[model samples]
Target chain A: MLELLVSGFAAIFTDPLAISMVFLGVMVGIIFGALPGLTTVAGLSMFLPVTYVMVSHVGLSMLTAIYIGGTSGGLISAILLNMPGTPASIATTFDGAPMAKKGEAGKALGIAVFASLVGTLVGVGVMIFASPVLARLTLKFGPWEYFTVTFFALTLIASLTGKSVIKGLLSALFGMMFATIGLSPVDGTPRYTFGSLQLTSGFHLLVVLVGLYAIREVLLTASSKQEPIKVLKYKMKGLGFGLHDMAGNWINLIRSSLVGLGIGILPGIGGSTSNIIAYSVAKNSSKHPEKYGTGIPDGIIASEASNNGSIGGAMIPLLTLGIPGDGATAILLGGFMLHGMQPGPLLFQQNGDVVYSIFAAMVLGIIFMAVLMWSGMRMFVQVLKVPNHILIPLIVVLCSIGAYALGNRVFDMWGLLLFGFVGLMMAKFKIPAPPFILGFILEYQLELNLRRGLEYSNGNFWDVFTRPISGTFLALTILSMVVTIINNHKASVRELKEKKEGTA
Target chain B: MNSDTKREVQIGIFFLVLATAYIIGTFGISTFTPFGNRGLDSRSIPQLIGLLVIILSIAHIAQVLLREKQVKALLENEQEADTLVCDEDEVACIQPVKGTIIERLDRVFSIKLLLSFVYLTLYIAAYQPVGFIISSTGFLIAESLLLVKKEERKRWRTFIILFSIGASVLIYFIFTRYLTLFLPSGILG
Candidate 1:
């Protein structure tokens, strides 16, 4: 293990191409992520084909850099513009936009950059040391166990529902039904293809992502308030933090990073939730909680730290169990497969070098982003000056091109349009698209596992309940639903009390 | 337009219609058995989803109706208080009536429907004859120009067009030549 680790570090330093690739990856990723509607997943997917053409190790390293950089680069727009560049940076805007309003945009940007660097380093450290243990533990999982784990992850939809459980469940059910549109996994029979060759292959996940997020966002923005909101031009200032500042916030940074890491390790929850949870924790524990959303550096720090830390946390499950922690990592999993590498326990034994290179590349990527964001803060902020109307249309065109470019299929373009319309309706109706997306992603695996479990038990329905792991997972799913209901009831009661007090 | 009221009514109607449609669709497809799987069929998942949707929709309609009643009562109380106020206070109280949910829904849906139609028309028109590059480039420039607000049109027209054209060209070259990904060759082929 020591030898592999040393060789990994040595190879990264000695191979000039690896270092250059990491740098280039970070640059490209930052460009994609700093642009609104372009997420880390899109960035990775767009670049996936290129990885197939390159050497496996080099490709993995470059892709890892892109993943890390893109995830961190979203903070740029979230801090500068009120619009979040990626969903992961949504929490950043809560305080970041306020800071910009208060003429402390430069200070906020500096703190975010610093925090991202520290958070990424901590996450990478955990990944390097803790991945093996996680892998060993997960290796014991059977089909029933996998099914239950997926069930638990899907229960996250309840937490995300936010005052509309019925609507949320309907949306999720719609997603699950959409997933059943392709060929059946067990019987090898065409399901909902409607006799079209295109439907037989199933909907491309990238097309779904672009349609749901980018296309939907563009369409929604078209009728939005036309009056441009004026943002103050705050001059770029110093890097702002000294060694003492770092030392003072070390505890907070570590705590937030861990929170981010834990969230990342979970299958469904990703950087978006991590940032929010970390920000809340940091604010709640602070001596001045009232200053949280009022342009405080701690808010930016907590958000950026946790969001970037999620990159490392997400990669753990992808590398070890072939289960993606989030959408971005799922795209990365596709890249891994493109490189002829299947992620799981066998991957560690067979391709340890490539894995270590990826780890090293992650660390280097954070370093690259830190240097670039620190030095190029002004350039990134200039991105905010681009009007939304112009920006949104360009994104629409790019999405069209991306869809067509994927397989040179006109049907894919049709798929993109169809999904975009679905996404628009969903947004208008206040249905959460994320759970639908998650359901679509997991649909294939869910069907495959169900079939395998059934085949093992000769169609005995009780087999799923008999397995300890599966049983535990089912219990947890039930527990999550019950908790969500109780919480909703409490919230309703609180609202009623507040109304009564207002009336009195 | 009171959006809350319109939303409640429209959503109730939408759920009822969707539930009926899903049930019919599932039943229509459930009969075809391409494979002999006695346990579960392709229709099973869709049927399950349809059932869930029906249940949830009924629940949502009930909730919406209950909430609407509460809101109506609250508004009645407020109106009673307003009627007791002096003329000057009544003038202050009588601000512009808020837009209804239907109006907001119309605003959001109209734009989305328009864009979807534009893209759909573009796709159909250019799928074969115009090819990917020419159609995509033209769409990009035209859409950018259209999306620009009227006041900024003069200031942004030149930059937006130039940037869109440049970006389209760059993407065309990158995907076609470097990445070796083939694009639709409509009429340009």
Candidate 2:
């Protein structure tokens, strides 16, 4: 393992082109991450096809770098503008904006960047060791286990859906229904093509991702009142604060990192929610919970740490089971498939060097994210000075080009507009996008495994209960759904009681 | 009666129509049965999805209606204590006045938003004919100018134009040269 790790490091450094690509990918990712409404998924999807021309290691390395940089980039806008550049950074805004307002923007940024680096390292450590063991264990999984796991992952859509369970179900169902458009898994029958030759390919996940996220954001900007952001100025003295501040929060850092890693490894949830959950955990566990969301470094650290840590956590399932934990990793799954490299136990066994190289790239990417963000702090803050009018137009044009470049078809661009409208309407009606994306990604796997499992069992659906792993996962799915519903009911009742008491 | 409830009803109705269309469309999908039909067919999952969608839409509409009724009752109770009194001959004074068409149009479609949609639509329509570079540059400059408040448009014009051209060329070269993905050339090529 050490030798492979060393060789992976050598491969990236020895090749100047690979190193440069990593740097470029990180820069582009930061730009995407720093921009509101442009997420890690959008960045990954836009760049997925571009990596098709490069070698497997180089291409995958660049994509990983982008993911790392994009995940970390959201801090810039979150701290400066109170607008989360990415959904993963939403928790950052709770304290980050307050910190900036208090003229501690530099301190907040410093803590966020440092915590992000530490969280990423911890996650990478956990991923490097845990993935191999988990993959080996999962190798024993049969069709029944696979189906059950997928079913369990689908239940996680509830966790991602914020407030409305029904809306979440609808979104997931919509995604699943859309995924069935092209061809049936078992019978190879063309379904819902509507006689168009282009429909046979169905919609590219890139098209859906970019349309729902990037394009819809553009339309939203155009539709809304344009307001220039107010930028804050701050003076820093060497990473904004002393080492003493970080030393005091070591426990918080460690705890949040672990939270991020655990959440990230679970399919269907990733950095997007990890930061919020981590921040809540930190607040609940803190000596002074009231100090949170009031320009505190602890909140910043927890938010930044877990989100960045989840990056590493997300890679584990992708590399081990070929199951993406979220939208971004789903695109990473596409990146692997595009390179003709299937990511699973077989890939790890046959291509140990490349797998290790990806691990090395992630470590290097984290370092680059830290160093670049620290040094470029001044320049990144200037990004906030750029008016939305100028920024939105540029993003829209790039998004248009990116959509068209996929399959080199005008139809994809049209699909971008269609999904853009769909996404806008979904947002207007408070329907979440994450569930829809998860549903789309898991639909093929769910149907294929279900049919295959039943076929193997000679059409006996009751056999799922006989397999321990399958039964455990199925039970867990039911348990999770029940718990979520009960919790929501309890919270609603509490809210009502409070309101009544206030009125009285 | 509230805008939020109106929006919810509209969304629910839209989904209802969409679900109906999806279910009807699934009838065209034929299962390859010559090899022996086994397991779930292609149409089954979609039909199930359609049914679920219909059920959910109806439930959401009902929820919205119930909420709207409660809100209306509360609003009526609030207004009862502050009811306005007028003479019997004051019909014009008592009646609620509606805004002019121009005022309503301005509220619904502001100049900035309307122009934004127009430029974007034109850009998309011109993309295949006039080519990517030209259409994109034009869209960028116009949208940028339109986005800014009128007083600042004059100052932003040069910067917006220069930046738009530079960005358009840079993007075109990056995608075409480095990535080897061809943007539509059209009249320009």
lDDT winner among the candidates? Answer: 2
Off by over 4 Å in 1: A1-21, A32-64, A77-87, A90-105, A222-238, A318-323, A333-356, A387-390, B5-38, B67-113, B159-162
lDDT of 2 by residue, A1-504 (tens): 678778988988788888887887887788778877567766766676668678889999999999999999999999988998888899999999999999988888889999999999999989988888888888898888988987787777745566766677778878888888898888788988888888888887767877777676666655565567766676666777778878768999999999999899877678888999999999999999999989899999999999989988988988887777777787787778667777776778777788888888887888889888988878777765667778778777877776677677878878877777777667656778778877787788888888788777776888999899999999998888888878876876686566455545
lDDT of 1 at A233: 62
lDDT of 1 at B175: 70
Model 1 agreement with the true structure over A46-103: per-residue lDDT tens digits: 5655555567888888888888888788887887777777777887888888988888
In terms of DockQ, which candidate is strongest? 2
* Model 1 Cα shift for residue A450 (angstroms): 1.7
lDDT of 2: 0.80
DockQ of 2: 0.31
TM-score of each: 0.85, 0.90
Off by over 4 Å in 2: A1-4, A36-38, A45-49, A97-103, A341-353, B1-6, B62-118
